[model samples]
Target: MAKKPKTAITPVRSDNYPEWYQQVIKAADLAENSSVRGCMVIKPWGYGIWENIRTHFDAIIKKRGVQNAYFPLLIPKSYLEKEAEHVDGFAKECAVVTHHRLEDDGAGGLKPAGELAEPFVIRPTSETIIGESFSNWVQSYRDLPLKINQWANVMRWEMRPRLFLRTSEFLWQEGHTVHATAECAATEASEMLEIYANFAENMLALPVIMGEKTPDERFPGAKHTYTIEAMMQDGKALQAGTSHDLGQNFAIASDIKFSNQDGHVVHAHTTSWGISTRLIGGIIMAHGDDDGMIVPPKVAAQQVVIIPAVHDEADREAIMEKCLGLKLVLETISFDNIMISAVIDDRDEVTSTKSWNWIKKGIPVRVEIGKREIEGNQVFFKRRDESPREKHIMPEDEFLGSIADILLSIQNNLLERAKSYRAQKMKKIDSLDEIFNYFKSEDAGFANIPHSLWDEGLSEKMKTDFSVSPRCLPIIDGELSDRLIIARSY
Candidate 1:
């Protein structure tokens, strides 16, 4: 077998997967750590990609009858206490505001003042708070179904924080809905899972396995939790998205009642589902190579970058003119119904420097125009997914005509590659000892553990013994089975 070429990134993926991840973020200029502990400053380039993901996913949920709304950021401590199990689940991670003002400490510093009668907890999740609104807004069968979505920032005190994966504060979209029937709520939850899976595959170019969380892993106060799990380049699983069927737990806790068709007041069934900025982390791990991130065309900040390979100062004018013209043409091409974003790197730096810089940023395609290419009426191109050492030449007209299709191909190819990698890593194991040994291997991936092996203590033991946990249990043929998808996770 031929050895893989060395990546431009130091401490490449093969050398250290975690460090390589940080390097990729740095090389791509995506984000950075902030002065506030456990938080990050998402740079413009990073936020642009996130904005694209947000805009695309927002349309998807809206099409499914969800309407945008906003709720308070601070939840009264009593509100969280209304739901016992929910409060217990998030108590440790909740950040509380004890005072309303700051006062002089009589020294050179200031101290908290104006102590509040009731502390307000920064929302870890908004189910309880949203439930309060639902209880007040719901009055009759006419208002039985209420679906609201919020794009907001949430905070959870994390002991160990990574840039995008486990930040103290991050942005996300949460969808909450009320239904007249439990069956309808379940169906809504399932539908959202499908929507999330589709978006992950089609837009993010990530292949995910849709499944249900075990009772032990289900969201607190939720009847059931459904998730889309994807395997990353390092063979670890990442929980990409999740939807929860809250049943009547939240409705009952918040006193949300509505008149039924039969003329009796009944508690409404509710569901809450969300996808967060952690998705950015998933994208980085799932598709990024040792060189840097390979953003799918649908979610890339910039899909194409044109570089003028000016070998002679006398020819710089012509080379730059051609590059700018090609940029104009490429930007007009649309892929997946989104206009292509292209930019020309007409920097005064060396041609190799410009080419390598955009390569590190993982632009889907890079086109080089020079005097020779102009004379030949052709252009040189390179794909981010392929080795940077390799380049291809094609007629200018053909390249322009096929640009959209080429991007679509790259999107499809990334999804297929992730699917293939996951397929290679998964296996079925029946015996407990075999399951344990499977995870102990150096290159361990995912294992299908029998349902009978699960217990309340399993999660802790797996974390201690193997640094692995159950990702989800597969839902097959409209039923959830005893088989479990277990693997190490981010």
Candidate 2:
């Protein structure tokens, strides 16, 4: 049997990975299962992290000439059928709306009423409906290279939902762009993939492998699909984000045609890219430890949490006053272009309770101001990146002065740590026997397998034999190589 843990969370990562993940989310109070099956309700703390992610990525895309817009939630059934491949891809997972209203059934329970002439689909993705808009909006060559993005929720009926990773309903930002030429569309897709990689590495402090998906795994109707895949603590791979170069497939299907400078009409080349709330799961699995999550400093909802240590009633006011003052000062500071956000814990709980709460929630820095520290004009601080038992005492002003640099250090350190972890788990396999032997351990991570040895049924065989999948084929030295990364995935 696995040993019990000291903290509120139990069944450590090595003991039970799936349960450990759910426990981490529970201890952090990030999100919870909703009344509806395959759905989740994101709590304030979890939403705050998502908000940070949206804000940063929004700024980045806007700088690249992408405009944010809203798309319809319900799409006509015929619209999806315009693209044969797209419809086939999402047909089984779509939620169809057969009736528009509900009425009281004769037997007491309410029942669907008023069958519509044509069915509507709760959008599993906005591609089809958004394509209709693009068809209507683009009429001339001047409208070429139109870039649009939408932040919305989508529903894809999942049989086995797992919180943020594969919920039926989840929030995401999808970028759709049109170009005059196929080359431009391909470039746009590649650029968006790079943007996602930067966000994963710099903001989330989660290292990822970015590459092109194989034909069997490419997005429906896409010429090529680029993805950023991150390795989890359990040695499984998670597809963090995807960008698809759709060529002219979607444009032609939706009739998005435009007049060219040469006095000819042609279908526009298009691209679509997205990153979803699944990234929250990626963050949890990438940096979380036995103690709990270690939120990257760059995107932490609360960078610094001040817990006053007041044993005597008289000392409460002074310590709290100091904490409030520190909060105000910390708010005014900036690090790596991110303004520091801090909070004072004035709750009626013990200092240990407050500290552990924030620790599980993954606050980057924790400070405790006590009678002795306040009197001595010093601050006791601990970094989430270090051991929970380790603490440092520094003059109050010095601590405040170095806070920004300290946070930057923590962010870099987390990325470095993840990089090292991935490096240790990565191996190069030249033979099929070696690949089979490597994955036999069950914790087998990533293997760089040569495509020359790939057979007609290798992918299916791998899945059946070891539950592993080919992650991606990376481009090296400006050439697409036969080498691919194969691993088990979530």
Candidate 3:
């Protein structure tokens, strides 16, 4: 038989950094540019990863008694004006629908596209609109704490969109809750922040630091904002998730209040938290390698890929039977061409090429079935991103049993690897000058600087002049350092 040449691919990290990132997204088949300039069409493979992440994170919110709901994509212009700061924060990036539709040229005559007197603005966040609903829903103390969550897409006009990192339009789940007292709202805000940290470290196998945002970094309508920041492979921090304590700003703006037991009319406190598809970007940046993407087992859509290699028809039939049988155990199973992979058993290509194919896709587990393994009544499996593939051999009957423990180990190992990197990357220092010095000296990773006073000038200056923003002003309780400001963010 004639031979086909192998396809050569460039390595990431050593390659141009941005180019490598572009290649990572493409090679992984996450998404690509659509007809629109900055918009992207998220392929199923990429959406599958998002589904895995959303499923687990959504479960966390549902477990806390937060009911799911949806709000309009476009909000009335007046709603944004309710909170002065919120409008200022999002005005520039707002995609305003000035005229819903324009008259078609004379060639086709004017088409009735649509009409609008006062065009609605696509929501950058649901705080304003959600606040309006809260005002209408709560008339008394009985409607004190109203917890609601919505899964939707939002738009932000970013100059340079990097797939999941900073896309023009992205998918995320936002939670808005109204509380009778500031204490209850604050508790809910902080609780969601912790939940985000837990999800990052455990499910996504990503390490993060939980804290409060600096003055300039606080959410537009929020009195206080909290976040979970994760450091990427390049040492840049990514704000993985955020929770904001709105206090009475939104409540007062929307006139949402309740009469207490003493007949005193009091404003409610509000909070909003969100974790977006941006997380998929973080996971790629944090856990991926030069070879390609590396997904943690818990959230990996395709946990295992089985490739059957048989010389005879009978052998192939038997192997196919075994592959079909394993479907009951795994939720997502794939048996298809590895998608342009330049490796095939029948084709004379290096086994390493085949290995790279699976690595690029970040499949958690790979099973290689061949005539030899079939004759031996066993299967040869390899764990993605794991070295020493020699340990993957098992009898067909006990294969699943033997590898169950290993799959878990891979999940745990990835989390620890990311956690240790974050701890090593964080800098705990004092003084404002020290923050800049640390960035210059240490490749500018996430800084855990402690500064006295949480004043606006100090924190706001860092944000505007420098790219650094505050992740959070963490709740220290008694151990809380005096007004110490943490400088650094995404």
Top model number, TM-score: 2
**Can you give the lDDT of residue 394 in candidate 3?**
81
Clashes of each: 0, 0, 7
Compared with the true structure, all predictions reach lDDT values of 0.90, 0.91, 0.74
Q: lDDT winner among the candidates?
A: 2
Off by over 4 Å in 1: 1-5, 456-460
Please identify which of the two predictions, 1 or 2, would achieve the higher TM-score against the true structure: 2
lDDT of 1 by residue, 1-490 (tens): 9664466688788789999999988988899999999999999778878999999999988888899999999999999998888988899999999999998999989999899999999999999899999899999979967999999999999989998988999999999999999999999999899899999999998989899997777898999999999998889998989999999999999999999999999999999999999998988988888788888888988898888887888998888888888888888889879999988888888888788778778889998888889899998999887888889899999999998998999899899999998889999988878877888886789999888887767768888989888889888766788899999988
- Worst ten-residue run, lDDT, model 1? 2-11
Query: How many backbone overlaps does candidate 3 show?
Result: 7
List of clashing residue pairs for candidate 3: 211-472, 212-471, 212-472, 212-473, 213-472, 451-484, 451-485
Q: Estimate, for each residue in 254-349, the C-alpha lDDT of model 3 and write its tens digit.
A: 998888778999899999999998998898888877767777777776677766665566776776666655545443322221111111223343
lDDT of 2: 0.91
How many residue-pair clashes does candidate 1 contain?
0
